[model samples]
Target: MLTLAISLLVAGAVSGILAGLFGIGGGAILVPVLVQALAIMEIDESIRMHLAIATSLGIVVPTSIRSFLAHRKHGAVDMALLKSWAFVLPLGAIFASAVAAVISGASLKWIFTGIATVVGIKMLLNRPGWIVASDLPAQPARSAYGLLIGFFSTLMGVGGGIMNNTFMMLHNQPIKRAVATSSGVGVLISIPAVIGLIVAGWQRPELPPLSLGYVNMMAVALIMPISILAAPVGARIAHAAPKRALEISFGIFLLVVAAQFGWTLLN
Candidate 1:
């Protein structure tokens, strides 16, 4: 119990910093860490990925809220974009999370591995001046993007920020605006995703004690407070830091994590 508690606290602190630093809602970091921690705790292999993803979403709820409020105070968030994407995003999250609940754990791990690799590569190569359009996509295209963002992010145990930031950047939005708005998108994605995960895993067997479906109540208790408190500090640093260096560092970290997971899968 002591070891688990310590692990959760450490994971929460790292996640909070990453959330604030990259506007990623911390799930990209947390999910991988949680998967390993849960395995050490002797959690059932069949449900470990689902539990990790669900618990990560639960943690995101508070962390994203804190990050969003902090970014809003800085006047960096794009409220218009957030409002436009809000409704459809949750729907997509719900749909995808439902699908996630039924899939095999190994398959989910592979999915996460693929996404982490792609995101890491994108972050590593991304340039501030890169742009695909002078404006956000219109109508169906915008809606499709929102749906895809929510769907895939939920599946990978993320809060939609990585994809959201990239999408907004492609539309020529400022990085600060993209990051800030992505925080809001994380909140929207996480709330519904958590609910869906709980519902989908409610009757499953072999879940760890104190689990509500795949969401581990104990983990949430241990992680959320620290993550929420630390997130604002990260947001402040993000606004003050040299972004390119941070991006490269974070990208390398993600790639290393992905490689580790890939190696584990192979052996």
Candidate 2:
């Protein structure tokens, strides 16, 4: 019990720092770390990925809320767009969770590995193609981007930040607003994604201790406070930083993480 608490504490601290340092919710860093930690706790490898992914979402829910509120304080969120798209993201979350459950762990690892590889290559290459920036007041259709974000968010376990930011950037939204709005959208994506994971894994046998369906309650308990508290700090940083540097750094970070995922799969 003491060890478990310590693990959670460390996870929370790491996650919080990452969230503050980057505009990301920290799951990109948390998922792999949590999976390994669960393994250390004697969790079955077969189900570790699912548990890790689900638990990460569970933790992310509160953190994303915190982040959204923080950004809202900064007047960064596009409430109109968020309200319009809220209805469809949950459907996407459900679909993604269901799809993830059907995939075998080994296969899922490879898929993650592939994504990581792409992230890494993109980062290493330092791609400089910037999306056109505009805020024409036209929101994307609810069903289209919402569903796509949900699918990729759940499937990749990264919350929909990358895709959402890309879409916003392409449509000519200001980068700061894009990141902030995406953070808001993430809360929407995570709520249903966590619930869906719980529903999908409710009957899953061999789950580790203190699990709530696929989501691990303990992980949520441990990570939520730190992530939430630190998010505002991240928002402040995002407000001050050069958008292009943040994007490039995020890309490189993705590459490193992706290589790690691939290596984990092979070994």
Predicted model with the maximum TM-score = 1
lDDT of 2 by residue, 1-267 (tens): 677677677767656544544435667767877877888889888888888888888877777777777777888777877787778777898898898778867666666667666655644553335545434334555468778878777776666665676677666677678778877777888888988888888977798778988888877877788777777777777887765565567667667767776777778
| Candidate 2 lDDT score relative to the true structure | 0.73
Model 2, TM vs. native: 0.86
The model with the greatest lDDT is: 1
Cα RMSD, each candidate: 1.2, 2.9
Report clash pairs, candidate 2: 116-258, 120-255, 133-172, 134-172, 134-173
Model 1 accuracy (lDDT, Cα): 0.90
lDDT of each: 0.90, 0.73
Worst 10 residues of 1 by lDDT: 16-25
Q: How far out, in Å, is residue 139 in model 2? A: 7.9
